[model samples]
Target: MTKISQLDANDGRAELMTDEDVIARIFDHIDNGTTDRGQSSWKEPAVNYQSVDRLDAELALLRHRWIVFCPSSTLEKSGDYIARDAAGIPLIVVRGSDGEVRAFRNACRHRGVQVAKDEGCTSVFVCPYHGWSYGTDGSLRSVPNGDGFPGLEKETRGLVRVDCLEQAGLIFVRQNAGADRSESVPDMPDLIPDSFRVVKSEAMEIEANWKLHLESALEGYHIRSTHQTTFFPVQYDNLTVVEAFGENSRIAFPYQAIERLRGRPKTDWSANGRITYVYHLFPNVIISTFPDCMQVVVIEPLGLERTRQHMFLLTDCAEGGEVLEAVFKGQEFAAKGAIEDRDVVMSAQRGLKSGANDFLEFGLFESAIGRFHTVLKREIEIPAF
Candidate 1:
């Protein structure tokens, strides 16, 4: 239970466990033949995954929580913006000229049409349907006809504002306007450097429950079986350093090459090329740090049987060379592993109708997934506002 919150007290800027510290822990676990475990095993009802009512409840709960929309690197310049669906709400996250990040409902005030599409840079967002335009700060800047709507107050006709904050190189938006902004966000490791820049952005949909995809990233139990040719060759099987902080957690997958540091000086130890850290930013986002690049993954439920995944790759390299080569290689390796898990989760989703078991049992090795369900249940129980 070495939470990041306990690392330091710098106004929620707690230090992440250093590479030296994390490496030592991994070695200790390897020698002791034990991995982190939950207090107890947990079971979640199988029907919950398939029930429309449960899906609705979970989607509502997401609105009351701060959801990670994208990495700050994605919006590197003022007027840069990304528009997408998050928690079933169309959102536009833009960086204003003041160098502050802001979010607004994508729908235009005039015709309910989305003012922006996808990602780009623009000082103003114009509705294609009615020529209504809004500034990057979400102010209604102009209208198509000046005399048609004489009584229309432009001050209150701007795009709906959403609570957004850029912290620790990540952008988080609270969909519910009334949600207290002081609430805790994910306690993350300081992995994304200020030098990092977005290298690629991609989106895809999978025919599976979002939780199933999240569970795939939380445990290493399926590495040997599911990623035999992709990750198992370089990474150890079922060996991880798991730590929970607040409602978030980090699971480190150590590479076999870590044994090289066995007799080396502690000061020389580093996690750079020896491990991949998968951070479960509670509810629906995962940020994984690879050797050459880091990826931010946001999953949004598209339907009872579908989920959309937004993936953004960021790196400090700005030109093509060995650095860029390694970055793309890392991205490809991660994508392969993801596809393998996607296949398995889709099959699992299809299995929900089999009625084979009432509850899906999570073993000690899959404790992070168990913790996720526990936190989710608690949040969903508090009637959605």
Candidate 2:
């Protein structure tokens, strides 16, 4: 029942309202016992979660669109590289000596075996299968035995390159080379400051659909019941300020302590410890802010019922014993909440297979989820073969 303004016209993103503006809106909703609502609700077919054909279409859409590969800070040095599977295709992102970031198909040009297995620093990637070496810039530097093949052109045999863009402290990779190569990365430099450093990272494979995990993060309607013992005591339930930025969205989850800012001057108010800003970058990236660090989660879909989640914890504190101690504590708190949410999503995935309903209903309180489905449906249209 709360009235919110439309997105900004210039940038296609919601305006970054001040702390005072957000706090006032939260209090207004609380006083009226109302929540934000979308233009309308949506009904998604349950089969969309279990159909193999649907999964294929979804993955195809992912390959053609721009997706976040990893945080730019992950590849900090010239030789640093992170390799992983994206949209079912193995990808390697490396920082070149010239300080430019680039992405390439992980497969070697000769035998197609992945040259880079995991994240590490290496001057050149030498394929384990055949000793074919490629430079950090993705050019084929050496083949074990040049005479084995006659008139081999190394320039034409370099590793296949994918479209890559480094923007706003994040690295984005388009899985397929021919997909629209235009650069449209969301502005995130201010949201993720340069001072921040990656302090910790962890990956998990979940037995659930990727979209289900993302839906859990998009709205706070389930916090009271699902995270009653973990987050409900500190953060409100079903209360969020959602804003759209092109295909992406930002949700503000305010803590109970936010009420303390009521008497402070608007200019003096800070969102640091009182509110958590969760930014969703289109297809499958989440950047969340905490008191002392930022948590970045990349949702990589493996199949209709499988997903790989890569999480990174970042902090900006000066190097010191106390700083390390605080960073660990912050990570621990974030991990606990993540575990709680994971359990909820896994259970939802299991229930969806029970044939209890033909369609999964999304109510007004879960408008963000509706918007996510809207975008997904628009992008996953099956083309004529």
Candidate 3:
């Protein structure tokens, strides 16, 4: 089995096993000849997420839309995320009796105290704050102090509610605690493609700015140096980048050159067609795809200098084998090289805060980074701050 990391350093683009270079060709060329590079912009990074301002809103959004995992449709099991409100108060997001979702502040109305944590199907939420209890629908069903407060209205005193929307297999919430659910619902897409679905995932904590870490995953310019021996770039490489919203971008690369140089088997994947996409959504979500697999990363900021990297891996391989090994080995090799990229960006974070390196650079080839910086500029603007 040949690995991408092991390729001849002397081999240049001219040596590609094409009709021009190869004494032979694998098959007849289609009318459209192959050359790599996707829709790319020539700009520098100026996105809003790069600054310290947008951090509060992004964190607020993540916590409000608590219990975001996979649909029971894919996992065949229930999983949820219960997190805190802006006031550091916990909230519960779970399936109710009708199998519909519900969001309730994990607090008691009678005496203003806390409720449950860690999710499971409970008929009702009995607040530990007081002997007060609430149904899954967030109704104040039982109260121990029935006579203590004669005028107390159970209807008026249920857990404080929050907003939620499930789209593209993601649960999103508003940053404000009392943000309207109807208004939030209006902005969300009602349907989602399975392509946006997820499989196995893990979360990792790191010492870095959230945008610094997220932006790191959106570009491939580092593949050549940082991933030299461990990935395709060391042997054969190229890039094609596309810009998204101001702070978001995507890059796609065809694996044909490495396949030819490494003498790997011809796959249905086109050397010149069927490009794989690496898309970065504004703020903190990214989806990186190869032909048979995709890894989505959702970032959570811990502080000014810390972030949690939650990665989800989806693959066509139902089980592992040598064939799967060949593909995922390429992925793991790529994954390891990310550490090298991380070292540089994390250091960049520490350096940028010093205000000396005020201006950053981007290349004509790095339009993706340029788009990223642009969007970040829009998101971080606050009238006061």
Who wins the lDDT comparison? 1
Model 1: which residue pairs collide? Answer: none
**Residue 91 in model 2: lDDT:** 90
lDDT: worst 10-residue window of model 1? 1-10
For each candidate, what TM-score against the reference? 0.92, 0.93, 0.64
For candidate 3, the 10 contiguous residues with the lowest summed lDDT are 1-10
| Error of model 1, residue 340, in angstroms | 0.7
lDDT of 3 by residue, 1-385 (tens): 1112111211122212322222112222211232223244433333333545556655544443332333322322233334333223466766666655656666777666766675455677777756688777778898785887888887888877766555555555443433323333222222234543444566676777776776666555665766666655432243542433223344554444434433433433343223445666554667666646667666667777787676666654454556466656656766676677678778877776676554566555555555555444433342222
RMSD of each: 3.9, 4.0, 10.3
Residue 173 lDDT in model 2?
88
- C-alpha lDDT (0 to 100) for residue 84 of candidate 1: 91
**Candidate 2 lDDT, 1-385, residue by residue in tens:** 1112232221234556676777788878777877666767779999999999989888877787678888878889999999999989999999999999999999999989999988999999999998999999999999987899899999998889888997787888886635355566544435678888887888998889999899888888888988887778998988988777666778889888888877778786778888898988777889999887898899999988899999988888565668778878877876788888889889989999888989988887777778878777766653421
The lDDT values for all models are: 0.84, 0.82, 0.52
